[model samples]
Target: MKETLADDLNLLSAFCGVRDLTDLSQNALYQKYQLKKADAFVLFGGSILSGIDVLITAMNNQVATNYLIVGGQGHTTNALRLKINQFYPQIPTKNASEAQMFNAILQLKTGKTADYLEEKSTNSGNNITNLLQLLETHELKKDGLILCQDATMQRRMAATCSKFAPNTTIINYASYKVKVMEKDNQLHFDRKLLGMWEMDQYITLLLGEISRLQNTPSGYGPAGKNFIAPVFIPQDVLAAFYRVAKLFPNKVRTANPAYAKSLEN
Candidate 1:
């Protein structure tokens, strides 16, 4: 059977777990987090350049008076390192952090760097863990913050932040992007590629997120014990995941071994 672009979009959307915040009432139920009370615009660093763009725009727009760029070496960082070295070969990729790479890009773009940078976190869990330590050590307050990351990761980011920093009011500002389209079994962003990931790479990363979203003990977040993602996954989304898994067994196998095993069972 041939899979259509609709199948791919449906699956990718399900896996992304992007929350629809529109339900929150405008006035009291949902009010913009006051930038004045925020400690900083918290940027969760990764290979996603769009996310960084949103962070930069927020900074430039004075959404927050300060900024905290947090990330260490990981898959995303490694990919970003390759992109960074393509232009600046002098900067060594080894032991490179997302913050370091982003700082370089920021300097190249605006001739400046972040107000604070933590370069030891390798995952979302570590992102929050290291950031909390950095904030405390630096004597930063926990009044409020605008959390920014890949749009696909908004739910997980909220979950992690809530678990780790319950006192800090986090306002999520995610990267904006159109849905990934599939043509002849290949995924491509309609606009421009956000970061260093290719079509297949994006598929794999998104599937990995879906695996983590599963409410199994082995998964991450509130669903599992690995991380603290408290977001709920509706039944329709789960059905879409299974449908896509059926279409791309190899990718599901590689990106989410745990979920793959579950599917097999």
Candidate 2:
């Protein structure tokens, strides 16, 4: 039985992206910790407007007492401005950091703002590091955190959180769950959502996360760049990543030059 490309994509998406966090995903983890609510709900800044929308929904649902938006200008910063102009035209993004843009949308939608905004970190590694430092300076809760980021990077974010905030419990609530459907021999979303990514960009992100999540010597894990702690990668997930990577050649986003420099040290 020859499986279709879509089949592999489905498996990859399921393994990579997590939806809203709470009783639905990991109730047992919360029960074990006796956690009634997460100490904070943090949204990692990206081009996805839905991440901000969903994060605000979580806030309205009282998922956490503190809300933090973490990010500075990076690769996706300009793309995010495009989404802002398209979806949130009222919000000004003049020379704004990623966190600032997200905060503006959050405030416009909910009539409130984030408790803290860490606007200095430019990449995932420092996103977590700066967030921890901000938490310490503000005396914010670190017991449990519901983290929202791009769907492709959710699992990696959890691993990064575990490395930096080892004692804290993390709930990965990805901003979007990507679904690719084959039509006319091309992949497209079932329908466009706000802040939707182009198909090629989406594929690159999905494949790139697997590259980072691999436990090999060049991966982001402890054995690799040591950017994140070691986390188990299931065989099925690894297989799916390889199959899809083979199917879509050369679309994976490479690590930044900064990471290359770190590996040289």
CA deviation > 4 Å runs, candidate 2: 20-33, 258-265
RMSD of 1: 6.0
All candidates' lDDT scores? Answer: 0.64, 0.79
Best by lDDT: 2
TM-score (C-alpha) between model 2 and the true structure: 0.90
Give the residue spans of candidate 1 off by over 4 A: 1-11, 14-31, 34-37, 87-92, 183-186, 194-196, 253-265
Could you give candidate 1's per-residue lDDT for residues 1-265 as a string of tens digits? Answer: 6556456555565446443322212231134442343577777776376556666676666655678888876556666777767755665667767887777777667777889998876677768777888889989876676677776666677677787888777766555545666567666666775454576666666666676766687567564664664666777666666676676666652332221221111
Candidate maximizing TM-score: 2
Q: Clashing residue pairs in candidate 1, if any?
A: 221-227, 221-229
